[model samples]
Target: MIRCRQFYLGYPNSATVSHLLTWSHWIELLKIDDVLERSFYEQQTLLERWSVRELIQQKESALFLRLAASKDKAGVLQLATQGQQIEQPADLLRKPYIFEFLKIPEPYQIAETQLETLLCDHLQPFLLELGKGFTFVGRQYRITLNNRHYKVDLVFYHRILRCFVLIDLKINEVQHQDIGQVNMYFGYFAQEENIEGDNPPIGIILSRNKDELLIEYATYQMNSQLFVQKYQLYLPNQEDLRRELELTLREGTENASQSAKTLLDENDDT
Candidate 1:
């Protein structure tokens, strides 16, 4: 019986066993690779809430390049490792959202009221663009202080941020006064409307043109929750914007160094 068993388990049988084992190992590795790939895509989808089409669009748009341009090496690695997780649905919304849903033309020649109306019309998309946790409170919200009636262009509550966001739109260039005015609006909200758990209100002054230099100077002395940003009827070159942001950050570092030097010189003279 032993001799018969040895003959059955001959060289050909051993080779077949070895081949089967090799194929099984390959299949196992392939399964692991598939799981990792699926996890990556799933993560990205959650983070960006990217539709398959949108994901394709992002790839074509060089979204990774844009992200690399904007973020540091660590940030890029972190984003890559973590993948995309949409903590907020609003993060998925595009900024300066094209009102294509309204069948509006390329250059939307409309007044501020018209823009507000369009936003109201496409409320869902607008909220998405506004970012996570935005609930529209009102439009042209009126507030009277010191016998003067001032109207805020738009008011929103951000649940995640736990703050009120006051949006003021400007068709022209943003001015120093605009910053001050928004600062005041933030003050009013903080003093009057903000709930106990809410963070300080945020004021966004959006204009067709913005002077970064002026904004820097204006915000230097103020602690108010105000942010100034330029808005375009059509999306400007994202690369140009990224370049500008890099230059601005660089200039800030240079300015800080110069100020420190001046302070040291003054102290020495004293």
Candidate 2:
């Protein structure tokens, strides 16, 4: 009884969403200690309509850490307050997307085709993992150009972005050629596949490994919207991810202070 009162005291907004959340949901949320993280999960649960089990899964996967690790301090605060507003193409990205629902054991030696098949078989969970606004178009979607045929591993339409998202899966590390290939698909999609009212297509390369230096060199000054991210067959190490998020936050804080100092110096000079 005392704990319940303390929980309510900590979370004043709980009264507003009382109609939506059950005791089970509150129980799952109570496990969280960070106020910002608790608010994030609470808001996302309402937005995504996640069940108790799904909420548990997300918390275990360290969804907050995964999303916050890539953002600046303001972005992290927005996540806590607004719960993932997808206004830009970059907002759709999540680093090292998790696919533990596939139930595939690690040391992933499976073929790319097999991986695609597994994701398709577990389509519902995959879509949820992919984040919001993704509606699957087709698997092994074919693209024809000049009497030649190319198969895209997976295709999804983003309702919010109003664009087609093409995915290419790689069991091994991503290469320069892979980026060029996805970029070509993006061009083809922009010209041939997209109809009126459609935004330019974006491409994603999902691989077991990603060489950041290779991607940086390969995608330098590229015009198209293309992203390369790694996929984990198993759940991530939450402690490691938390440490990474903490480091990113500390760096962002330092950078923000440095920028403020620079601005003050400029003002003084003027």
Candidate 3:
């Protein structure tokens, strides 16, 4: 029988065992520590796939606090992880966004009949409002479908979205039929114009009045892509805008505090 010494009892690599065991306990403790704590380092390292240096930059920039400020936490997470992989990147939330199409120099008072002409005159700005990667295909595009003629107010092709955006300008209240009509337009565009990789065309109706309930029901049933936004000829009250900003700020702060507390609790339980 071979006599084994205490140091060489288990394995041939005695020095290797000593080296690994010396630090192994601390490493295991760290793994348990990470499991027991919701460290920002661990969360960010997993989520953002950040390098040590990038993690430092994110901390310096207060990225987590900024992310916590979002009204939609899921959307913020998606943005952080995927970086805005939207098929149709609409500016649905960008209030007071610049209306480049409406910019006209003073002393050049143009008639309402010349609205389309004026828009064409400053087509660049109009295209910008329509969103990036948009090209002016045509205005007053006439489509003959099902033995009926339909005239689209404005037609644009969005390169990034890889889809077409059909816009209908309305100076009055948006009716249920109006929504149906735009949805029909979307269907037509999807069937007739959309390429293989392109997303379904998006239809937008910019009207003076939009009925929330009506819009809700209209969009609920239809699989066709569409959005409706109310437009104002004049800017809103500055005081009202300021009050809204203040309220949003307060709400965001409160929500952030609550989220942090919840995270801390989960960590404690762990």
Instruction: Report RMSD (Å) for each prediction in the order shown.
Output: 14.2, 2.2, 16.3
Better of 1 and 3 by TM-score: 1
lDDT of 3 by residue, 1-270 (tens): 122342244345755432322232323223322221214334444433444444443333333333333335445444444432334445322243333336556444444336566666778545533433678888888888979999888888877777788878766678888888888888788888888998888787876577889889878867546777755434344456435444655666789999999999999999
Ranking by lDDT: 2, 1, 3
Output the lDDT of residue 55, model 2. 88
| Model 2: how far residue 79 lies from native, Å | 0.8
State the lDDT of candidate 2 residue by residue for 1-270, as single tens digits: 755986778767865665698888988888888877988998888888999988888887788888997887788888998888888888888777998998877565789999899999999888888888999999888989889999999999999999999999998999899999899899999998899999999898998888899999999999548999888888889889778777877888999999999999999999
Candidate 3, RMSD to the unseen true structure: 16.3
Pairing residues by index, what is the TM-score of model 2?
Answer: 0.91
- Which parts of model 1 have CA positions greater than 4 angstroms off? 1-44, 47-70, 83-108, 235-270
Per-residue CA lDDT of candidate 1, range 105-189, in tens?
7655777778767778878656644544578999889888999999899999877777788888876678888788788888889
Using Cα atoms with residue i matched to residue i, what is each candidate's TM-score against the true structure? 0.60, 0.91, 0.59
Query: Once superposed on the true structure, which residue ranges of model 2 sit more than 4 Å away at CA?
Result: 12-18, 255-270
Q: Candidate 2 clashing pairs?
A: none
Q: Find the candidate with the highest lDDT and give its number.
A: 2
Q: Write down the lDDT that model 1 would get.
A: 0.59
